[model samples]
Target: MTPLHRVGSALAIAVALSLVTACTAPAPTPSPTPTIDDSAANTPPPTPAESVAPAGGSDPTCETIIPAATVEDFESLGWSAEQDDFRVGATIIDGGLQCVWADHAGPATDHVQIFGWAPIEQDAAYDAQDNLVGEGWVREDQPDGVYITENPETTISTDENGYGMTYLFGDGWVKVADTKQGLLLVVWGD
Candidate 1:
């Protein structure tokens, strides 16, 4: 072959060798992660302590779950709710009321809402990151069996270009705690 043809042939052979080497290369092994599978062991999922509600048809609110004294203390710490709306409904629990407070007076200026859940809703809370499940907020665990949102820096806005109301956590934190009485207390603030 002419020198040019020889050089071209050599390049072709080199390319072919590289392609063959790549095709034969072993794939990287994935590191195994520890996982718990109760089904495999024939063990059922552990159930949480049964939560009971207070006597009567009363609905739990933030004020109910959190003591009045505690609410005052929080207000002293710059968390103030000017107007609050409370409604008895099944938003969190059967016959439970949900409360929403708006235009808070504080450095964060956040809106607050509270919810109470029954034992039936225990699984929902455990599975949820927020007071309500599947709202885009991330769930974090506390030492006291409480599930709260991780850095819920959401803002409520009407502007479509801006973050809308669905991002309701606000520019602080949203906390949910199961009160043994089937009550889930939620607070939005710093």
Candidate 2:
């Protein structure tokens, strides 16, 4: 062949070689999953400034929680003890007794909650223990007994005159007192 024909053949061969190389190239493999670091995997979630759990599940009553309405009844909750937000009676929730809590009850204004029967912790020793008493729950009425005068969250009810009003236990969600009932004398009174 002439020199020009030789150059043309070389160019054609180069193009054909490139096309063949591209068509037969192997496909790319997928990247492996990245391994998770131990520290990050084991780290606990940070708690917020404040959190609230609502009430739900079983019916909550006073007799089940506090045997009597006397001041002593309040102590059973162990509220005075110090601890985090989840102390025994801080929020007073128990699943075993049929009680449950909803962390996000609602907006700060609304007191929506998850209320249920608070369960009594099981103990092999106390086989027949505390069946008479139950969880300190908030129902809309007089919970079969007098209201204990503990728990800063506990409120006494009042009318326009700021006088105490009667609590008909079972009202659904009763008497969250805000005003002073004649200097606390009438708080929990009829």
Candidate 3:
């Protein structure tokens, strides 16, 4: 065959080989779209921040890390500690402790989360603050609790739809406090 014909044949063979390879390839699996049902619509989503397990040799627990919020603690702060309105989520992660508390009785949803770790080598406080900021909480000079002198301002109302205005907790995130264990951080939000 002429040189031109041989070149054309080689090109045709290459195209045919590619076509066969493509046709024989397995079809890609389609990823299912995540769906939220009506029941799940009201369920609060997990915090968007990726919680890092505690590092170093320190190990913390919910009991050791979370501060006690007594009935008086709630009442004095203008929050009812009644079980009906109080909900808590606490867990140990990466040898560290994380605890969250919320009063769901009101029309709005607000929560207080405390994180504790020992040794205080890394910037856990800064990380917590960054996580809260990333979650869209606006920073304030002081949390409403700080300004309360006597009784907390009562603004409770029946939330027929159960949707109330969200308020960030504490003066701000990264409330780093020194304790016997190490560093403690308190963050509050909806």
Query: What is the descending lDDT order?
Result: 1, 3, 2
Clash totals in order: 1, 22, 5
| Model 1 quality (TM-score) | 0.31
Clashing pairs in 1: 52-181
Better of 1 and 3 by TM-score: 1
The CA lDDT of each predicted structure is: 0.38, 0.28, 0.33
Better of 2 and 3 by lDDT: 3
Error of 3 at 62 (Å): 2.2
| lDDT of candidate 1 over 101-163, digit per residue (tens) | 333543343334333223334444444334444555443334444443322356342222232
Give lDDT: candidate 2, residue 150.
23
**lDDT at 177, model 2:** 19
Give the candidate number with the greatest TM-score: 1
Candidate 1 yields a Cα-based lDDT of 0.38
Candidate 3: list runs displaced more than 4 Å. Answer: 1-59, 66-94, 100-124, 141-190
> Alpha-carbon error at 122 in model 3, in Å?
6.4
Clashes (candidate 1): 1
With candidate 2 superimposed using the best TM-score fit, by how many Å does residue 189's alpha carbon deviate from the native?
A: 39
lDDT tens per residue, model 3, 19-40 = 9999999999996532212222
